[model samples]
Target: MKFTEELREENKDIFQAIFHHPFVRGLGEGELPEDAVAHYVKADYEYLNTFMQLYGTAISQSKKREDISFFQGQVAFVLGDEIHPHRNLCEYIGIPYEQLQGFPLPPTADHYRTHMKSVATDGLLGKTIAAMLPCPWTYQEIGRELKEEFAPEAEHPFFEWIDFYAADSIDETVDYLKKRLDEEAEAASPEDRQLMKEAFRKSCQLEYAFWEMSYTKEDWPIREEVLK
Candidate 1:
């Protein structure tokens, strides 16, 4: 089996949990509270900032023009195409997209960012990509699954969010990333491959946590000034 396939098979349980998570179900059923979704969109907007940074780190680590170009393309994709959902979400929330720009990530997202940053800064290209894969891959899967299951109408509040991830463009992006990871795996040591799997699993877990965070609107227990 391909390395990406293996990673998916290994993490099937977590993926299932995420699919069944209340926040995901609410999106499909068009029943999620406005506050919950607003919280999620704002946190995710901040998360994407770090997401693009990882792509930049990947570009810097790449030696081949094709690899660098691929990473660069992903950065553009995230910055351009991915933000449509945020805009739709902001409109739904009655907030300007710019207002959400500097929103702080809550606890789960902050930890997830810390994990990805560590891998992107210190790990080899394959492992770093592995850590990053769960975000796009899971969203693609979730989007496709929701589209197939719910057949959300264009009027659905979350339609743009669903459509964006389920788009052919996202499919192309995930396919490219999967192929890249498999190519990287071919040259990786067995130890490196194991590390990659671990990264993939942790990321999958965090993906689930991210949903939970948004569902709960996770926050630090005390005000930042309390400690000061």
Candidate 2:
């Protein structure tokens, strides 16, 4: 089996958990509280900044011309294409898009960013890609599956969110990333492949946590408790 396939098989349960998470379900049903949606938009907008930086790290680590180009293209996509949904969500909720630029990262977003930064800065391109893959990869799956299952109407609050993630363009990116990851795995030592697998699994786990964090409108517990 391909390395990406192996990674998926190993973490299939996490994917299911993400798909079934309350935030995901709420999105499909358009039942999420506005506060939760607003928090998600702000948090995810901030997270995308770190996401783009990781792609830059991937580009710096690239030796192949095509790899550099691919990473650069992804960075552009995150900036140009991926952020539109967040912007729409912000407008829908009356938050200024510019405000998200300074929005504080909640605990979960901070931890996930820290995790990706560790791998991205570890000087291994393959591990960085593995760490980053689950975001787009799982999101594509969730968007497609939710759209299919819920058949959300255009009036649904998150219909655009679903459509953006379920787009053919996202599928193409996931396919290319999987192909590239497999190619990287073929040239890797067994130890390196093992590390890649671990990175992928950890990312899958974090993906689940992200949905839960959004669903709960998670905040810094210490701050909340201190104020209480």
Candidate 3:
């Protein structure tokens, strides 16, 4: 089996859990609360700086020219393609995207970002690719799956959100990521391959936590109690 297929098989439970998550269900039903959407958007927007760094750092760490080139292209696409349009959509949805400046990091958000940074900065090629794969792959799969479940009209509240993930561009990016993962894995030792698998699984676990956190509007768990 291909690395992507094997990895997915290993974590099929988490993928199912994510697909069955209440947040995803609410999104499919077009009944997800606006506050939840806003919070998630804000959290995602706030992380872009660190996200850019992660990719850029990965590009620098890569030994292969193709890897560097791929990451550079992604950095541009992320800033120019995704964020600008997402900012516009946030306006339509009353998400205060502009007000996300210096937003406080929720626990889950911080943990997720820190993990990405660790892998990009600390891990080798195979491990770094494994850590980053789940986001693009999972989101694309979930978006396409959710759309199939709901079959919503173009005017549906979350229509554009669904379309964003299901877009041809996103499909191409997912393909690119999977191809990179395969290439990276092929060159790995048995021990490093196991590390790569663990990284992928951990990233998937964090993906689930992020959705749950967004649904519940998670915050610093004990900060208030500590202050008191």
Candidate 4:
């Protein structure tokens, strides 16, 4: 089996737990409370924009030319093609670009950002890989669930976004990470291994929280809209 497939198989329980989470169900069906949905949509918009910005920062901060070049290519791909999913999501949520500027980021967003910054600043490729692993892995799992349980016609705007992040690109990202992890492990000290493991667990917890936050009455207002 491919490494991605192997990893997915190994993490099956985690993936199932996330997909079955109420937050993910809401996203799949668009059944979240209106205010909660809107809050989540707005939060997602800000999150993606910030994510792109931080990728730039990571690239610039990379001391190795190879790392810089690799990230530069990723940046170009994200800006050129990967951004369309976010644009589609913004349109679906009725959020304008200007509106996102004033949006208040959720506390989870801050935690995620701080974690990313720490990973980048630490300059350990293993730590960075550990921090980044959750994103593509989670996306791939979401895409699989969307395809299995959601609309096949792709009428929902969020479906595309899910497909984009969780489909083929996720496999690619995981493959890259596996190679990097191996390389980093070969060179890592015991302390580095401990740090990487801690980062990985923390990142996974954040991933779970991210999905949970999306389903709350406090964050999403779709349920209220339905009631009204």
CA deviation > 4 Å runs, candidate 2: 224-228
* Error in Å for residue 143 of model 3: 1.5
Give me the displacement of residue 169 in model 1, in angstroms.
0.6
What is the descending lDDT order? 1, 2, 3, 4
Q: Kindly state the number of residue pairs that clash in model 2.
A: 0
- Find the candidate with the highest lDDT and give its number: 1
Candidate 3: list runs displaced more than 4 Å.
84-93, 222-228
Number of colliding residue pairs in model 3: 0
What lDDT does candidate 3 reach at residue 226?
Answer: 92
lDDT tens digits, residue span 74-132, model 3: 88988887775356447556766677557777899899888887877665766777888
Model number with the top TM-score: 1
**Candidate 3, residue 216: how far the Cα is off, in Å:** 0.5
Which ranges in model 1 have alpha carbons more than 4 Å from their true place?
225-228
Q: Write the per-residue lDDT of candidate 1 for residues 1-228, one digit (tens) a residue.
A: 999999999999999999999999987887777788788988898899899999999988888999899889988988888889888778777888887777778989999999998877764899889999999999999999999999999999889989998999988888888999999998999998998898889999999999999889888899788989
What's the candidate order when arranged by decreasing TM-score?
1, 2, 3, 4
For candidate 4, lDDT tens digit of each residue in 17-97?
887887677667755455565566656666666566656665665677876776676667656776566565566767664
